[model samples]
Target chain A: MQKKSWNWNRFLACSEENMRNLQLQKLLERNSMSRSIEIERERETDGTKGCCKMEKGSSGYISEFLGSIPTFLRRCLFQVLSFGPIPHHIAFILDGNRRYARIHHLEAGMGHRYGFLALLSILKYCYELGVKYVTIYAFSIDNFKRKPDELQYLMDLILEKLEVVLSEENMVKQYGVKIDFLGNLKLFPEPIRKAAEKVMAATAQNNGTVLLVCVAYTSTDDIVHAIQGLYKEKQARIQQTAEGKQMGDDDEPVECSGGSNLEEFSVSSADLERHMYFAGYPDPDILIRSGGETRLSNFILWQSTFCLLNNPKALWPDISLWHLVWAILQYQRVRPFFEKKKRL
Target chain B: MGANRNGDDVTEINRIHLVGFFPNDLFQITSSWRLDIWNLVIRLCWFLLHQVFNTVHIMMGIKRVLESYFVPSGLLDEYKDLQLKKLRYLAVVVDSEEALQTLRIIKLLQWLSAIGVKHVSLYDMQGVLNKNKETILRSLSNSRLWEESHEKATFLNGGKMTLEFLSISDGREGIAKAASYLCSKYMKAKTLSGNQNERVFTESDVDIALKAVGCGGPEPDLLLIYGPARCHLGFPAWRMRYTELVHMGTLKSMKYGAVVKAIHKFLTVRQNYGK
Candidate 1:
């Protein structure tokens, strides 16, 4: 039985209670003195069990009413109170499109289409849940390395999604989401790039939600471009400043002689954020990676510092409102952490 | 010790296990009664540890898979000498009520200080609590860090100021008032206040209110955190613009060994995000 591997008795027998305590003690020894005490205090406090047992008579109505309310509604109430704290900026590694298609025994491009459908719904759900920023890693820097036919098909699918943005049936216009493409756009075929540019231009005015579509994106590549851009901006600024100084005219406003790479002279975390592709936008509050994958396959590198990560054992195409809700629920659980960290 | 020699040649010695354990309805199974809270806590700790171990195992497995699938590549030569050391001054923005965790966080900071980490400014953005200043002072007095800090070493002074004045007013008017007050009343340009949006003072200029007070210098370092999510929020971005943020997961998940390990890795490891 699967339960055999999860056998609690054997696991406990492997190490006696005293032995386990000793092990814990040794581990605690490695920690700082105050930390150890804090940990101990936490352990002691948590070790104590608290039960709020209400009387069965008068409060029965409340419980009954609560039970009568739909589970979804109850969840919505919980969500509103919590505000889904962690993972303010979330990245979606939209994987398993092909597998989902195969599982459903559908056509090759159908899976990608279904994934887009799911993305549309989930995007709305995220905004409703108060998620500020969402980045869907629709394509990878390495994905272009796939077989030629598959690559062409994927590119075609992306173009379709982009085209759909302009379609009257599409939600991009309805939702007013700004679409920004991250990754090496130059690496993509011309048609795909043109389609992407069309969507970006169309949604440039809308500001309700920012959907970062990482088509040919890789974390490392993003950093490289950011640094290169920073350098270029800096050189241009220096040239402008030097020219201005040479002209001996201070009246043209200091802004024209604006300095860049000033961050290099004195860098801070904010400087790095401005240098990033998704500058001005908030970092991901929650990172949702489906397909049962718990690892960040190089999503946002510098930006995801205090992000709440939600890994639902669902496929990319299988991601529904429930999965998004579950992720938000998870974020709500650790809301205090975000609240505390925000003070910094 | 086999190091993770990927991308930037950073060693894989430091293992990060970001596991979150939340208490819900089922949590009552082990901890419904008040007395059983201790027992439930121990079980939860064990559960958390189990999850952490699972995460580590998964990370190792993924590492192995990547190793087999990919070829070993050299570090990006252009970014080889990327100093990144200039970025410093960490402003930790947090909510007001959860600022109570500041006591626990103080222990973390002390551990941070012991490890040669300098200059952290704490700002409470959300004014959730309204406790008496005397009680707050007494609470801080009980803390070892507060006791250890020199006259110049101030950590817990900025919370109240940030929450009341700076956070909402957007660091301009409040900072100016505070700066002037500090210069006139305290006679120090950098007088530290406790529990406010603009907490630590480095100068009379209100602009520096948004700038990080310390944690910047010749030495390249890190800004370790214990928080809920990843975004720095409104943490006076001016100071932390380039800081290498290492989220220690949540406060409950924070471990001393983890901090040491992360710092050890940050210092020893080389970073190359781009190839």
Candidate 2:
């Protein structure tokens, strides 16, 4: 009986291996077919004059044919993924644009352009995956220490991309993506800051997705900002009470005197939270840092108490949709422990 | 632009263009076909190589797991070398489920002591280690290894090793205490100052509040997390602000090599402190 059971287990393993190999072969065949179709499309585009219309027709047909497989696969995978809990807010520490450019031997500013494109793709994927809030560490306050020329190029590139995104009607109107600049806007120069303001104002009414671009931001700076705001609030309250007292002195004394409540002055965690820049949004569920760095680098320090830190060894420009999918899958695995810890 | 010898050449080129579909272009078709086949062959070879490498890695992992049952002599020396930097304060955070094993805790403590760790803090999200603290200390004291004279068994060179136990409750309670202290301080200051319009509160007020409540502790130079996942598991945030967090994968599969690697990594790291 033991021998028979051992043989049965071996047979089951062998069959599983065979099934995997068969599926792999099928995937390879499909991939090759798609590659051939791409080559044919490229050949048509490179051909002489009369082939343009034919090229468009063939390309459209090939795209429709090729797109069906991924859409189908995505649908199936989405079904499985939807059954698990999804992260509501995801933060990204976009690192290694310069390193990516150096590795690819590209021009100084081109890597950031590619990184911006990758960000757009990831944002679309996250919104589609029902992630409501997406925060990106676009520009840190520390980044200003880079070379003057590179810094200028980055500022220009950011401005140009912001204008392009604002002009793209479908991105805002169709997707309902509200663009928010989540840092000290005063740090930026006039025209670029104005453009950022314009973009935010343009998408103010959209409620579908929130895209927080942390520019000139650091978590420590954010904490200091919150402290300053709280201090100002306390000062304002004191002034209001003093004014009210003066008014009471001039008129009939009121029963409820504001002076007696001076002993009740206190600061609460809620007060500090209310003064935070990210006050309304939920804390990030997952904080992904690309470029293989495991450090937080002063990004969202206070709010990431339970945030799952995912450090994938890929540059910002090299990030793809699967990285986001894998991060969500990891979040699902750890969600139980996180909930348990929170309950305790 | 080549000079054609006859009208046939011109007509031939025109026919070539007019035919549009080059069905007899064997060179073009075969070259692309060869390229496609080459790509497929390379991909297949890569896939096979990856599979072989993965199997070898799994075998190595299993071997490491089996070896973890005993403390090897080589690992002991390596861990001793790792302590050459003299890490003053080290914190080990284990998952709550893994912290239930009291024997494992004693073993880990003994290992740390043998490796010359001067001070160690054991932490878990649940207060299991905290609850079993007295038992753990008693067991260690009764053990022959720890019962040796203090002069002979001193850690790293001369100093005796000390152990501290912490839990999530300590951090949460500390924060709550600090918050209430800040509230009372703020109220007292407001009542003392008759001029309410003056901005009296400063950053030092919060600092003093936390300090008065004894909420702040000396930051750990290095924090090693032993768990199934890499999350911090709500380790005291205030203490770990600048701490180097290294995830030493699951406590059950803990390896000396990983601990050595984490210590080496910490030693080489040059933290700029947000410069």
Candidate 3:
């Protein structure tokens, strides 16, 4: 909301005087290629069916000033920001799309397209800012309760986006971003599931930032899955002898009364974490839910115990660079307390 | 014009007056000072935003109190308001999971009881509320304590309030125990069935097992957190699927109108229950 909309002119104007080419090493060229999502907001006025905009989208969230800013100044700003702590992982709960559409008087379902566009734009900013992981609550398991027609449209849109990500021209391939389709992928239709799998496999070898797209996912389901995964992992390692003893990794597989003697296995805090959907990644330092709502809606509950939760008054489609920066500054402020908690 | 004037002032302030002291290291010194200035500016913005949020929160509290005042006397204590009629279950999440706030807990329960909240769940990560559940329950009048270990129903002033106590144990740790129990059951089932093929349990499978073991419960309609932190404080994930979480500051500074306002807002929100 406008709560965080303090004038950035001081920071911006001050940059001009101090804007000597400090880091002239290599300026990142703005890729002129077609963006993965191009929201044709004007097309919404013509009563067109709500769908993905294949062409470049010039939405309100994607500031032209941000993209067209001199590369050195952008770099200088980030250079200064990098001095303070930058969150290693950031998560987003994209809410308020339908509300945004209603406020703007858009056609039904166009709000989600704008939400997706904002997500891509935000993802680019996060990755560029050196965040190693960015997870989005794309579709929830409860979303299956929506009308059948809306569900079909959503599935189709997701399938198309997955196909785009698999292509060589998309941002995923360009950035070498590893994409993870978390949640119960088994719930999606056959075609959508297949597309999701294909995209995941295609980006499996990427080494850049990781984008976790949670489809049909709930935090409860994730925790249950983590427990199941942990059980399997431990089952392979621990022996099922009369006495419950931890087995070495290289030990021979021993068979016993598997069922009767398995009750002693309990996960320490560490074991469950390694088996979580976000294993090998740090917990998010900040989780922003844009939609003027202050609810998690059953999102990353386990991973966000200490994460700074920012419920900006901005809708999902209206989230811009300033919101992200403000969230980062807030994270920097409270990071010490969370660090102490983690240590304890 | 005002913004431009301020920008000019900032630019002037950005320059260094004592640069001759370190002529060779002036660039390094200048850049460092500029970075510091930028950091201060951003932090100042954040500080102002927090203040704005506080003001909005205080105003919301005032508005709620004023609304209750307009209602007929004893109507709110009776909770005859049509808005809160649909609120079946309410959860109070406190951030202070370590040190027990006995009086605060009692006062909150009494506040909830006055509002005619039938079903209330108290959650803190450290079992502080759960440990003091009996002490808190004893203070209420005509409170018919429920038969369940964690549940209590109090009938006061013709309005009944049911209370459920929860902590971290009832959340992930409870699930962890159930998971181990399920894994053991699955392993034994496979052994008895003589099936070498691995069996992967789904989310529903865990849900069923949890129910069989009496682990999970129905999701609450609203969760009001009493803390500086906006998180659920590890209140069981299984039960908060559709719950609307509202932060009402710390329990020490808790207000009756804030709770009323939170409920009023929750009732007005367009809840599209997908399932």
Candidate 4:
């Protein structure tokens, strides 16, 4: 009986070894399968098709087929969003570029490069969604408070990017975008001011979209500027009136003249409106501030009265297409209220 | 039969030789397999944890929404003890969409009264509140919360609340009127002084002009916005130059907690008006 039991145990051990060997072979097969899938994904991202065949086996073929589905689905979603109610004007307060750099351990000024890329992507998306006007708070008047070196870097970056936008045929020529620098141009260096003028002049007749870059701008300053203009205009009118009175010294008062023409010399709201920096453009429909800050930071104060403010937590450079879509969705929900107010 | 056994032995030897040639490959394959299994287990655990977390979050969100629907008990008492600066003048700017709900406006006023806010300015973009001013005043007066002093009866009773209804027409138009008044005043002063080169107009001149025309209101210490957006919705710009704006979300979902939070936030903030 003991001998029979020993023989049975030996048989059990042999079967266990065979099972282990089978498991090893299965694992090897799965490893190769995953490796091929990784290679296929890389090939698809690279946009090089024939190079995918350089990988030995047909294992990646299935993954290559599956990877295309996501791209296809994304394209479909984009098309659907394009058909939705698009905001006519979108304002962006691009915040947190430096913070993003600090978090990522990137070199100083490298974040602005990434920020520029993000801006380009956003512009493309906005244009695709048929946004007519985009006002970006590129550089605030308070930004000059930064360290001199940092400010210099920012100025250089702005100049470099502005040059690119001017010379890049695909961007300006293809889109026919009108670029307007809305701020105190006198504060800028002569070269930058001249360059901005050249760009504005170049795109003066472009009828596609309007892009307003608020450089060295603050709402307080804009208001003060408008007030000064109104003050000057009022002074000019007073002088003209005095001169007219002097010239008509002996003429009798025209009794039949319209009373409306002799109305009091109070400045009208139209005078202030006409002198505003954004005189021609309609008020921004939506003001988006990234980095989760709630304050307006003195941006477009007069025009933001009826604007929908959307503050997404993502840093400016980290903002995604979904953030924009979500904002538009919120706008769509509140659009009826806006229309109702208009009608009333 | 012996020849057949030898052939089988040779095949076994070849298989062993292949394994020996790539020892690291076998080890790597087994390790990777272990890693894959470990990854699957981790992923499953994470998914389950995420689902549970998401459900809890949704439940909390629902609870908060429900809580906001009703004003919490003792909120007024708690607000009394709050360490805040004297908020003498309070301005509430409601979105036009919310202005249609008279009940909500009344409730907001009642809530403000409970919080011991004596002076309040109610603003709406389309002048809806201004249009319904009589009804709102009547409701407040009739309610037990407000007491009217018969001696000096005005739209706002002297007891606990003094309410002002404002609209967009009162904002920019008022400023323009004030500016016109100031211009005329400056011209008269200039003509009287007969000093064309001298600076006749000062900041105080503009202030006096605005006051003389009764075009400007006392600037609110804190401006609370109850709306779908964070914007002031064209609140009188002249009156809100230094006002601390606190967006309290939509009026439909107004919460006592949020109101207290806004006041607390206002108290903690330090404003530097171009110092």
Candidate 5:
């Protein structure tokens, strides 16, 4: 067939097929360039099977050669792909801990403990990756409905975990992480509550990372509490006005914070944000619900604005470094899109 | 001596290699000086045009692939409209801080309201009426929405909460309460038949219930859930069945824009496949 001249606008507007062709071409070029590394990654777990197919020189040699590339250039590439304005905060709906334990034929409490330990490791990685905030669904407010025995076991497990987390020698101190508990802590047993408090107090000075543990938490509860907080703020404002000798007995409207109209008394989004449990922290940048099922069980309601979602078909305790790496890669891929939006 | 034993095998391989002459030397141009830009341009144009033709030819094939991964930017724009226009009832689940979180919830609801969104229900499974009582009073002590939606939304503490009314004081009792709550509420709203202790308000109780409150009519057009699993594990089914669900990960990491986007995604969804 006779060929036509090139048009840039046409190329830009060229439908999905053209875009796919461009993507595929890039993929093929990248594949060819990284063929050696790809091969090594594939062989990493089953090294013996593909040992004979490796090139002359050890895997260490290849790694060294690759590492020789300037760190700056690597960073630039990473930035272009997935960098700053990245998910400042990431929340994990750590579900199926018990199921994971069951699959491995372990006890339920043991599963939760394992999950807690895994979460600690994940938090360390988040800090390392420069993530400023992390929220975990530790326990639900609804979970109080469980049998007394199961609840007791969970409480014990949480107490032990909190003690470990709050210990001076633990990762919380080692990494300078600030800890906060969400949901209704009042319902927890005294020991668990005290342990949770100690952890929060111990990590209070550490501003390097914000770790929000949703123990006895539910999104519905969080919203309701936020509303409750707002009400308190309103009453305080009214009391302040009254104490100032400015109380007009005519049922007059009272001025609130930031000079919002008293007649309207409507709360702005920004105003309401100031009263949330996560008032001081950044909104979650990415929300990952790890389980076969895809839904956001009452988790973070108000804070997940503009967050990238990564639903991996793996349970919470089953989550590993590999899953974290995959999630990061996905974050990196979508990071540019979000960054561009921010700039706009 | 061992090499001699493998001589035939080596010879057979060599024979296969040279069986047909390959075009290589003519195409091999080692030097940039010998490159032909004009000829390359012509070939490139030919390739480009061929691709354009191929793309235009298989339109549906291209659509399927794109739909599988990328939801186009244009569609996202449309999503904004769909989300804003569609009647959405966002269920913000909270526990003890129902009063505390209510301010933020109201802020979120007010934002949605400002955007012309119709319903914003902050469902507290834990009945956070104590600690949050001060917060709620503080937020709405002078607000108009408090006065207007006061009946629709109010503070409920441990005492006022009931299993029959879906007032779950804690997580343990939430599930059963939620299920029964959904069933009864949906049943009554649709004027459906109740158990022996109740009256049958309408014929085709199940169907009417499903339609009016279940997956049918009065169904929450969209349910943008926030919290733990991606599933709406605790949301009342009467509202969740046909509702488009979008999860906002957690509270500590909550962002403002994510709420907008979740609503946007829900509004843009095409099918409300059965409950």
Candidate 6:
């Protein structure tokens, strides 16, 4: 009876201690959240605008000068940020564009329009930071499952953006960004595909930065495409080897086929990777999905095996230089852990 | 607000404050002393922001540990009563270093089972968990908490717990295997009509190939990564297309309430399938 009473008393004390811990945690969270928000507000209010939103209208030389002030300031920030590890390849999963439009009560295709502008700004930021590669998931094959009208609107918008990107006045010319479209181009309309090809050709010489736009693409499709390419290549080689063996004369065994048989065609990861669409390009270092959702949603599964995955609360349209910087910061923080994983 | 130092260009700057700072003016960047000061200030700001982010991360870690202990005695019982229907399959990925502690893994499983998780896939990069599968299964079975389907009389909490042990081989390496497996299988049929087989292979074919190779089982709805870094550690890429991955810290500090909280978060989140 005495032992039971002692156990009861211990349990009571533990419950009280647990209550205090919960309250303390809540208090700590509130304190930190408020402090961070205050700090963030001060930082954001200062120079949110960079060269990406360069007003083309007749705002006169004065507004332009005001904008250049922040631009100059940002360049300074980038200079300092360069002291840390700058990600060689940065990829963006352009999620939440449509949702942003919906929330803002904008037109059906305006979300994508804003998203394109955000991309340009982000690209400028990345280039300024000396990043070599920028990959954007512009369209997915699964996105085709949407309404036909919406898909048509998106294609038209894409064409317009292509023209904007191609013009000598844009960042493409300023940064020497070589544009390459990844994924299944065959699935897209002839005009879109042709325009994409034209853009690629126009900027092929530019070596400053490489911009990879994944349209009508899915990672699974990429893997499958690689598999198909390898399969066909192997079959042709086997056929050539078989013909050679057939031509060979005098007691040479045909079943084994001089050791160059189909059975000998061993497939490995590197061999499969060589056939992938972005085979030559290095894997993305940081994958930033600009939206609330944390899922990859079938974007670059094979490539993003070891990269940092950041899902900021901001939608794709709302993503600013701040978002990009935050993602890079997170990536730098986890670099040691990733390095350890690689060593293992 | 930009300073108008040069009297030659006299109009006040009219910049939009919403999105970005674009230098639309045709004026070239002039070197100035104040510009150097601005440069110094922002670099300082950058360092400060970096330190702030680091502090937030540390605070979150501390808060998580505290909150894990903050689970009330009553909530433990409440978790058992939680009818988790949304989570059809759950996965736990332990960091290779922590995967060695078999007892911790067992406790984690027990906690998960107690919370009414029906199916779970346990994974580690180096296949440490898979190597001890027999011992784990025997111990779990001997616990008498979960019973086989044939014996209805002998069972405690979970109706029947289905466990899957996974490793790196079942992930990235499995895809390589599937490729070769598909190649050899299709190469035989391709001899008849090589021209017709030139088309791109579809996703369905890959799925069929994976099944034929017996690489890995069904995709988990929620994958809990127990590691220092927020990584899947080469969990099967194909299966994790839409899997909600949550890092539950390392296995040494495995908490009952944290798992319960994660399961709760999983239950609360609305899974949108390409909507």
> What would the per-residue lDDT of candidate 3 be over residues B120-165, giving only the tens digit for each residue?
8888777777778788778876353433524322232335566677
Worst window of 10 by summed lDDT in candidate 1 chain A: A1-10
Best-first order by TM-score: 6, 3, 2, 4, 5, 1
TM-score of structure candidate 6: 0.77
* Model 6 spans > 4 angstroms off: A1-66, A169-174, A247-260, B1-49, B62-83, B142-158, B192-200
- Judged by TM-score relative to the true structure, which candidate is superior, 3 or 4? 3
Candidate 2, TM-score vs. the true structure?
0.69
Candidate 1 C-alpha error for residue B105, in Å: 17
In candidate 4, how many Å is residue A33 off?
32
Candidate 4 on B142-179: residue-level lDDT in tens?
Answer: 33321233432342335557777788876777667766
Chain B TM-score, structure 5:
0.43
Query: Candidate 6 residues A1-344, lDDT tens each?
Result: 22322332333343334433433444444465566655654464343333325555565466768955876787656655654567899999888888887886666876776676677668767866768899998888888888889988988888876765566424454446688999889998887888889899888887767989998888888999999999888877877766787798646655533333545557888888999998999988898888877677788788876888888889997899988888888877777777778888
lDDT of 5 by residue, A1-344 (tens): 00100121122222323333433444444456566655654565357335546664776578757754643343232222121223578899887777776776655566676566567557645654457788887777767777788888888878866775655434445456678997688988888888888888888887667888888776545544544455456545655775564545536443432233333444444554565577777767778877644445556644543466567778886786656655555454455544443453
Candidate 2 C-alpha lDDT tens digits along A1-344: 22322332333343344433434444444465556655655564456235434656877678769955864565344433443566899999888787887886666776786677677667756754668899998888877877899999989998987877667745465557788888878899999899999898888888777999999887656655665677567656665765787786866553224334444545555666677788898989999989876667767766776788888889998898778877876676677767766776
**Candidate with maximal TM-score:** 6
Give the local distance difference test score of model 2.
0.66
Compute each candidate's TM-score over C-alphas. Answer: 0.44, 0.69, 0.71, 0.66, 0.46, 0.77
Off by over 4 Å in 3: A1-84, A102-105, A168-176, A189-191, A230-255, A258-260, A267-270, B1-85, B97-99, B144-160, B195-204, B211-215
lDDT of 3 by residue, A1-344 (tens): 01111122222322322221211110111233233312332343232223223343676236545754654454445443444567888999888887877876666676777677677668756754678889898899999998898888888888877766666434455456788888889999999898888888888887778888888988877887787787677656544442343344435434455533465655554666677777777777889988777667778877777788888889998898778977876666556656655664
Cα deviation of B171 in candidate 6 (Å)? 1.8
Model 1 stretches with alpha carbons more than 4 Å out: A1-89, A105-109, A169-171, A249-267, B1-275
Model 6: per-residue Cα lDDT over B110-212, one tens digit each = 8777777777888888899989877787767533211223443332244668777778887767888888878876675565454464555788888987877
C-alpha lDDT (0 to 100) for residue B30 of candidate 3: 67
> Which one wins by TM-score: 3 or 6?
6
